[model samples]
Target chain A: MTHPKTRAPRVARIAGLVLVLLTAVSGCSSPQKWDLTNITGIMPQLKFTLTDQDGKTLQASDLRGKIPVLYFGYTNCPDICPTTLATLAQALRKLGAEANAVRILFVSVDPARDTTAVLKSYVQAFGPQFIGLRGDQKELRYLTKRYRVTYGLGKADAHGNYEVSHSSAVFVFDRKGDVRLLGRGTDPAKSYTHDLKQLINDN
Target chain B: MQRIHWQKHVSISGTHGRGSMMLALLLSCAVANAAPVPSVVITQARVRLLPGNLPLAGYFTLTNDGSAPVTLTGAISGSFKQIMMHRSFESDGMSKMAPVAKLTIQPRKSVHFRPGSYHLMLMGRQQSLSVGDTVPIQLQFKNSGALTVEFKVVPVGAQ
Candidate 1:
């Protein structure tokens, strides 16, 4: 009787220890809940070839060490583009110096109108971390097709003014150039700040 | 049913505070045809200006206190060379802005012109504007004449 009783207690104690260890292991490996959509594995890695504001060609590998946020818009967009860029600026402001690790890639879909000079001035107004990228129709197609986004240009009016429709999705990639989070222009600045901090801290 | 709608309006007014509650009462009275056509009041008018002569966006709240629905045709401003009413919409992650010909506001209802929705696209600045400066914009309405409202200019990130 004594032997059976002692064995039973020992087994129960062992099971309890195993349970605690299992809980701890789960706590370590569980995925974090991101404020933005956690698209860690849903999309392909970041890849692009576009001209920077300085008219220098750059590739995805060139931005390997920093977090790159890709946004497609034109300089002439009166409301959505500016508002979205300003919101991202606000998020970076919340991050303070940590924002240096972040680079907002404003890719102009309307290269016909957004020349390098126009893009440079337009993006520089947002912040130093912003980089205006322009690509030819072929290069732009390659990049947009890779992400499965679209852009359309409307018929130009008499004054050569036309409407532009582009992807409002904000693609956030980590330092390794792996696409991770997906955000929208309508998202609150706090959401960007929150997810950006996580992406920056993530290994 | 009428009592339920009135209670719902009261609840909505509760969230908007006392001034809105009074407006709600005034709107209810107007809706009952107890008063003449109430003039539309403009509130919280502001313009978001960008740097380097880029276009700007104007946001405001229009309260239609009249019993009849009012149609807002367009807006004009001396500060800008062109003003058009545009609505920003999102579909399948695509952001698109299109011109709106007219907007009809129901009786005793309010229309809010805000970001990601109805806005005044002010382009071609005729005069320079800085933050905190107020610019006058005339809002034209069909069958209701025009009302000049002063819109305070705000920074790009004001929203």
Candidate 2:
């Protein structure tokens, strides 16, 4: 019943309203600003199949929907390993309930010494939510090479005392299982908490 | 006894604000006179208790107030079967631990054995240890004789 010219302005106004609403919604869903170094496209092969602390096989795809904070160390490492785990625990504690959505994977480079039982006790000493993983030498070599992690076994003494040198960086992946950030072992817990919260807030 | 005397002297001097300069001189003199043999004071000594039979890490601050430099050659602990000086470092993203032969501290200087630096690797626990337990350790120095101290066992993740 309305004239064509009158209907044109009404439809155009409605279309404009819909467009404005869409823009606002999209803006709200946009990714948050991350202080960590962005390595989205440069991420290496993140897929893996390893033995978890429970002696069951787990695939990397199983952790797809959760953000993963990965650290490569051995259970026998006295200083840096424990220090990094402690820092991660403190950061997760600061995140409170949101930490439940995050997964901490501690990959042991010394599979020969760190059995599933040893890994479980070692990782659980830091936090109950921490999961320990260990793979055979071949599997570890593939994953470590893909992640650019370097590790070497120290010379054993006459008494069979030895050490394993491994990487200390904490690599972080987003909810979509994409590598997002590289956190250093020396970073403050506040920085880690901020970065994790930002990742949790992002889609 | 000596700390109390030093505090009393400082407080009495503080009552007379103009005597602050004399207080400084007296404090230096007190320090010089208090220098006993093996004048190495160990503070904040703590050992991280690892799970199972894993080696533990020890950290502390050592202050030398003697007239000459001192070298910490080794350490011994009753709770651990073997104790050795080790330095932990991160180079090119790889964490490395190497045995340290000795740590030399100059006179009137302090050396801090922290998490990422010089530490004592206490290997092979003789018995189970938990948080709040104290382990007796002795530090053998080249010049300052041996100093025995108690290292409190801390959580594995303690800094």
Candidate 3:
């Protein structure tokens, strides 16, 4: 609405100032997180309280403000459970000092066999840093449901041998208590590590 | 069959629409001398193959029918760069897997492998693997000499 000459110069001056400000702020801008954008879809919501291996009561909230890799299985479990945990132990050892910041949680789906004492020995065999947790059947069901993890109880035979069929997905929780991503299987692969590396870098 | 001693069932939840139950994992611990043992058949044998890593892993069970000790040492798998026997151990509460001289299979005894415990390391993967793929492996024992074993490709979380 104003005169052409006056309007043109005013607009130019405003644009020039905006460019200068952007240049000044760009240098101080923070690096964007790759994990946040890549794995934005599968956020996990899990919270439960159970007895720890040390016989102390604990809750999911206590694990807040740190990255945690959690799995659900039994101690007397013949194969995959132990195999996966061992891989985690190997992975953690490879992580060295950085591993200190990460907490690996072993949630016992078999509450009947996994008493606090049983969990203690089982987790201790995997890694000193591992935390084994056991709860009543109702509590375990609630917690597993929150994570969308599936598991089954097998029927007994005359000889009394039984097996447990369970989901082998590994859930990763960020420091903010958001379930960021899932690494499929009992043990992760290089791709899993790559994804994990991305999540760690985000922190 | 009479020589095989199966352990009792343990209860646990099931996954994959396999309803909750008290499942049974049959194990044979007895080694018989008077009776001729039935040869062990390890079905659904497979390894979790990791690309670019040496010494991948293979897990299976020992079913004895001949009633004698067998030393599993020599093995050949086209999928791996190398094949070897290794036992994974948990020490100081940390998991450690290392190469071993041999794995002894007692007469009429069966050994099982799962994650974080005893398993066969594939050493290295020669090709890429997918969820539904399968790789063939050959296992050789000190006494059995050669065994053609095929390992099914399973999810990392599969038992």
Q: All models: lDDT?
A: 0.87, 0.84, 0.63
Interface RMSD computed for candidate 1 is what? 1.2
Scored by DockQ, the top model is 2
**Which candidate, 1 or 2, has the higher DockQ?**
2
Q: Write the per-residue lDDT of candidate 2 for residues A79-127, one digit (tens) a residue.
A: 8888888988998999999998788999999898999999988988988
Regarding lDDT, does 1 or 2 come out ahead?
1
> What are the TM-scores, per candidate, against the unseen true structure?
0.82, 0.83, 0.50
**lDDT at position B150, candidate 1:** 84
> Model 2 chain B — which ten-residue stretch has the worst lDDT?
B1-10
Per-residue CA lDDT of model 3 for A24-116, tens digit only, reads 788569544432223444655558888898889888889776678878876645445656776676666666676676788899877776778
Q: Which residue window of length 10 is worst by lDDT in model 1 chain A?
A: A154-163
What does candidate 1's lDDT look like per residue over B39-109, in tens digits? 68788899987777767899999888777899999999888888999999998889999899999999889
Worst 10 residues of 3 chain B by lDDT: B25-34
lDDT tens digits, residue span B1-159, model 3: 122232233444457343332122221121222232235556557665332232345677766545677776756778766665656554432233455667777766777755555677554467877657878777666644556665777644344
Compare the candidates by TM-score and give the number of the best one. 2
